[model samples]
Target: MSDTVDETASGAATDPVLQRLSTLDRFLPIWIGVAMAVGLLLGRLVDGLDDALAAVEVGSVSLPIAIGLLIMMYPVLARVRYDELGHVTSDTRMLGASILLNWVLGPALMFALAWLLLPDLPEYRTGLIIVGLARCIAMVLIWNDLACGDREAAAILVAINAVFQILAFAFLGYFYLQVLPGWLGLEQTALDVSVWGIAKSVLVFLGIPLLAGFLTRTLGERARGRDWYESTFLPRIGPAALYGLLFTIVLLFALQGDTITSQPLDVARIAVPLLAYFVLMWGGAMLLTRALGFDYPRATAVSFTAAGNNFELAIAVAIGVFGVTSGQALAGVVGPLIEVPALVGLVYVSLWARRFFRDAPSTDPAVPDTGATR
Candidate 1:
């Protein structure tokens, strides 16, 4: 059986799949909107708030954002059954497809779209390419879990991407930004990025939360037993994922609120390609995985993983390599702005599409059923 994410609690009142969502999950779009507005307002109104948050002393990582991301990711990671991770690791089809989607098709698609859509905007184009290179390591888990995806599979895929990012990000950045463009007879931009710099992002953003979650799960299960850990501890910690997500959204946008608010036109321009990329990547991943005969949970997990980008890493790389005020940074900032709402909407889309999977599990939280790896 597949050890997928158990999103809803037992005895949930809402019977329908969508209605089974808690109030927080139910109104996620609204909360995300409110968070975005509040962040933008804070950045615009408050003096030096953006600068202060941006100046955190975590080296490549921002402390405030780190806090929220760690909080956001820990619960989902903790929810993973490490013992069952073996099941996911053995699924060569999912693993191979994840690598192809995240590393190969994902970056190549972004390069084409960036060149095709924003030819004149070099900085933003470069920024979008960087976003595509940095695969989802932080927020994809939340989206996957919320969509009722395979928990262990998502965790395994995320970890693999993190390791791959550390190794390939700099090389890919150089190739795409300079080598590929030159080969294509387009304007080539050189990126002076270090492998360590990208590796630091992986360590801080993903490594910390991953370690914490592993420890929490190992300890919690050992001390409390699996039944107690699953039923009691997991339910309590599960809600923290959304809380961290909302908190991170607020800070992420707040740090760039002034930029987002003042430059509406540029934000919109950067957003167009980003919105398209998210939808296309997600939809394409879902379709490809489904065609491979994956069940809903596994397909959903892979789709979310492939579709999401590591905005945190992208923004950091852009700002660090291209300067904070560069157009690249702005493009990176605009990524989550488009991605948050888009992915949230896609969650509902995934739920709706579950009807097509004959082996789909009972999405209604009112009924308790575990799914198997198909």
Candidate 2:
């Protein structure tokens, strides 16, 4: 196990892709804080900008945020080798574990934490639940690649999570938010969660970008050749997603600056449960990987996929289900604020964890462990 970790670490020390993570990527948390500060300043100085941006909406989705999210998702999806999705059927253990973690455990954990921590703040509790139910499909790819995880497995898990989210997100959300609260004898305001509304947000936020990414990769590879497409074109386009992420953060904070400034304690209260959720989920996923005896790459992939949340989808849903100005929406905006830094730190932890796991054994005959970093 120690030798496998040593080799992976040594390989990572020289890996060009890992080394190329820019200053922006390394200090993403700092940049996010700067964005928040800038947004607050702009909100105070440039009165009516947030109102004007908020006016541009389509079916409850904010136009600027929708655009930012689409750009943020495209590069990550484009990197997926869709041809390798066939491998999903062979790795049933990994798939099953992901389903259990993402669908069952993740939401339940958030539900408990939100109720326990923010009992007086129902809107924030709902927002936390929304975030918990929406499993990650996009940024997990970036984190997986950065940590030298099994890219193919990461891609498959992402695809699986996307499908499950579309089918179950609405139903699960309805149950947790409306039905479960009633069942638990809590006085909760009834929320009209339309399945079609959830589906529409999923389609716009995920489905469209997914199709665009597929077409771009397919056409680009055929035109420029796979080597050039992978080596040159991808590197050029990949950072666009991170740029979009930062831009989106600034917009969100700017829009909510008044609320954030007035009720700073509410933001802190919302943040506490979110912080606990991330730490607990990451720790649990790591333990699960170790117990299952997954190799370094696969373990890292599973750990990240399990821990990360789809903040974009969560934000969209919060706006759609609740109003754009609702506390729920504000809480959704805070999700990525906390997630970006927490996951980035976890990336380093995952890299360090590789040294403790045994080399991927040749036991899984159906899907041979390739141990290929790329």
| Per-model TM-score on C-alpha atoms | 0.92, 0.84
Off by over 4 Å in 2: 1-21, 360-374
Predicted candidate 1, C-alpha RMSD: 4.6
Residue pairs in clash, model 1? 1-372, 2-371, 2-372, 2-373
Q: What is the lDDT of residue 327 in candidate 2?
A: 85
lDDT of 1 by residue, 199-314 (tens): 88788878888888889889988898999887767776777788889999998888999988989999998998999999999999999988999888889889999999999889
Cα lDDT for residue 209, candidate 2: 77
* Native-referenced Cα lDDT, model 2: 0.75
Candidate 2 lDDT by residue in tens digits, 1-374:
01122234566567533233456655666877888788777766788977977888643556897787778778777776777667655888888888888899999999999999999888998888899988987677767765667766887787788888878987898788878889999756555566676566667777787899889989998898887876667777767777777787778677767667777788889999998998898889888988988777788778889889988778778877788778898788778767877887887777667667777544222121111222
Candidate 1 backbone clash number: 4
lDDT of 2 at 57: 66
